[model samples]
Target chain A: MRLFRSTLTALALALPLAAPTLGLATSAHAAPYTIDNSHTSVLFKTTHLGVSPFWGRFNNVTGSFQYDAAKVDASKVQFEIDVNSVFTADKKRDDHLKSPDFFSAKQFPKITFESTSVKAGKAAGSLSVTGTLTVRGTKKTITVELAKTGEGKDPWGGERIGFEGSFVINRLDYGVSYMPEGLGKDVTIVVAVEGIKG
Target chain B: MDPILALAFGVVVPALVALAFVVVLRRPFARTARGGETDLPAPWAAGFGLAAAYGIGVGLLLGWPDLPPVDVTLVAPWAAGVAAFLGLIRDGRVRGAASGVLGLGLGVFMTGPIEDMTLRVGLIAGVTASMVALERGLARLSERLDPRGAALSQIVLVSGAALAVLFSDTASLAQATGGLAAGLGALFTLGLLWPRAAVLTRAAPAVAAILVTNLWGTTLFANGHPAVLAALTLAPLLVSFIPPLAASRRAILRIAVPAALIGIPIAAAGAFAGLRYFATEDASASEHATGPTDPTSPSAATPATPSGTPTTSGTPTTPGTSGYDPGYGY
Candidate 1:
């Protein structure tokens, strides 16, 4: 009886370690990433004064996202933008725009985008990310078409992933409808992101 | 100085001058008091005095910034003209709701693109005639109502006027004048219908006037000359004083004394700053367009003769002579 009790105690001690090993073998492979903003940019363009296209870009944007090709269902993506970092290069115009008549940056300082549903693409294929985009204290759901630009090993042996994405949004739809009707309604936003594996 | 900073100075200085006027000139202007003397609390008096001063300062700054040296020639007359119109309407000398309607009609007529003064006057006269007929019809309706009901109607009318001013793109001088006319019309209609509710009736017009005046000031600053801008700022302060001046000896002193003291300096300083800045900017732009010439260069030695004149030796070539080419010297 004493010998049988000793064997049972040893089996109980080894069970916890064995359980993790089993779990590890089947756990989804997701690479954690930090966005490299120096190499990435978010640019947008819209018609101004009804006849001319005016281009603008957000300078300070940072976010983290994770991708698991093997387990497409487990991927997640998120992004945050500093709204005050808007640069049109015209001081008077920019100041007026930042006031309550336009962006009201005092009330809403940050814009954020978070992916609720992400479908992983096959190698060199396109991925679909459905996310919630919040701007000027308003939230809207948007589905973005993201094309994977492939992954490669950096000189420092760090893994890197790149993506190119484009989306269309109406400025008036977000309460920016004070234009005099000649300006274009649709704004095109393009995103290029490069991330390093953590 | 930064334009905005100068503008701030302009706004503050005229207010101070207006306040001084009320304090120092109140006793002498006792006969001009329009509103009866029910003494206001010191704080309220001071607050309103400051507000009035600020309005005057803003007007003067908009019109002429440099006091003593550079007189505000244009804005003073504009402000005086508005004050005179308001006074005429208030004194009952103009007589009846018809005058108010006529004024509004005239204002509307002025808003048209007519460049001819004679034709514009005819249009105004025509519109005024129709407006008088309409106001007379409304007077009949007001006469049938109880005092409370009449007051309520006036409130609604005044509220409507306020709403119109707030929502409409009435940035033009004509629209501003029209808004004032509408406000005054509502006030007069209330006074005729409910004499006892005169105090309450005055509330809407006062608020509307303040708002409309400020709106005018803002728009003028955005579009008009500095002198016009200054006058727009000062107009409201002067108008607000009319009621207080007429009511009581104490009120007259309260309104007049501060206005003179505060309004003058503030308006003067702001106008000076605004004009100075504009002049500096204009001068700099002109200088930049005409680039610096090198004394040793052949272009500098060549004479720039007038359009019909023959070119002479050693005359420096004017920018205009070289097709106004920006790169000619460089």
Candidate 2:
């Protein structure tokens, strides 16, 4: 009876000592990352006249992410793209894209995405993120399959992580239904982001 | 811009539909008025047709607007519907009040949700006054200019507005205006084909409402130049400047003089728009040649202001080896 009591006393002492270590291990997996705008790019390609793919991009993107490599489903991400930042080389076309016919930048300034769910993707180090995407006041759920490009420390002593994802969406579904025949409905969007550990 | 699509959807189809609707409804509409007066006293029979046909063209060209519209583009069809409804009332005072209400509502709605209270109130008063005045002005013009002259004036005004809006870098609104011009063209063409059926009394209120609201909408929502749109608003008034036409004067001069008078402001507006467009293009080219001085500057993030000029200096990456063309196909 005396030995049993002694062992019980030892077990209580160890539990308290190990609790902080377990907490640290859990917190290590949940890291915050701020998007590095200079290195990040949000590119899109839409078919022009049904003949070829026309490429364009948004220059201003800002967002952050919470990543848990150990539990992919626990990761969450959000991004805001300035609709006015749409760049298509041709100023006239860019203006049209920002007008009421497409993004309506003056009325709906920001195109945003916030992840609702995340799941393990088919490939290793990849995640399938489902999010509510808002464009021109219309909100729709869209899924993006993202592959981890790399994770490392930069020369400046900042920890960095990168991801690349591609997805297809119907512009018409988002109420950008101008020129139904001249411009293709389906647009392929590519997002490549580099984040600094915050 | 797809010229073929714009021509087909914005011009041809709407024109045909409007022409048919005007021609088919003439006798039936006249019968309704026969019991009351020598002609149709009801104002909406033809107005509704024009508004409906224009709405259809806007739908085909730029998809029908969403419920509880957020922008002018979405509100355009609804405004047309409201204008057509206003045409149904035979009482001039009541119609005028209703038109005033509509204009006030549009002035508040089309400016988007962020306009300050003072600006909103000013817009409301301006729009209300303009709507009442234009309705009365159109009524007088219809009586004095006759049906053909009135229709031609509408065509010129809307067409000029379309071209000016186009150069403002808002193609969808321009296309919508183009559709309206085509609908008016159909009305003018019907008068030529069947002189006995040429009746525009019913179409006056709707035409006035659509013209004023569209001009205001383009100027406020779509980056259209205020001066240019204002000139368009006053172009029709120029017809009033031409003294009463003598019966001995050439019959063709009735249409020709009014058309020429109204064309002045439109031509000037178009010229101004062209110069502005080219100036912007030149500035853009120079910026591209110089290239961006700083990749990470805030200037890189900021886009063009709502002055109908895009000043960003993004150098497009060349599509290499794939033979892909990102440049203008036309």
Q: Which has the greatest DockQ?
A: 2
- Candidate 2's DockQ is 0.25
Worst 10 residues of 1 chain A by lDDT: A91-100
Candidate 1's C-alpha runs over 4 A off are A1-28, A120-124, A180-182, B1-330
Error of 1 at B272 (Å): 10
Index of the highest-lDDT prediction: 2
Give the Cα lDDT of each candidate: 0.45, 0.73
Q: What TM-scores does chain A show, candidate by candidate in order?
A: 0.81, 0.87
What would the per-residue lDDT of candidate 2 be over residues A48-70, giving only the tens digit for each residue?
89998899988778899989988
- At residue B72, candidate 2 shows an lDDT of 60
Writing each residue's lDDT as its tens digit, candidate 1 over B1-330 gives 234544444433533443443244334433454345422122112223323443444343232222321111112223322322332233232333434453453434232434567865764554344333323322322333332333333333323332322222221222223323333333334334434322222122222233333333222222223343333334333333333323334533442343343344335534544554344344333323443332235433332323535333333333222212233321
lDDT of 2: 0.73
Docking class of 1: incorrect
Supply every candidate's count of residue pairs whose N, Cα or C atoms clash at under 3 angstroms.
65, 0
* C-alpha TM-scores of all predictions: 0.43, 0.83
As a whole number from 0 to 100, the lDDT of residue A18 in candidate 2 is: 88
For model 1, the chain A TM-score is 0.81
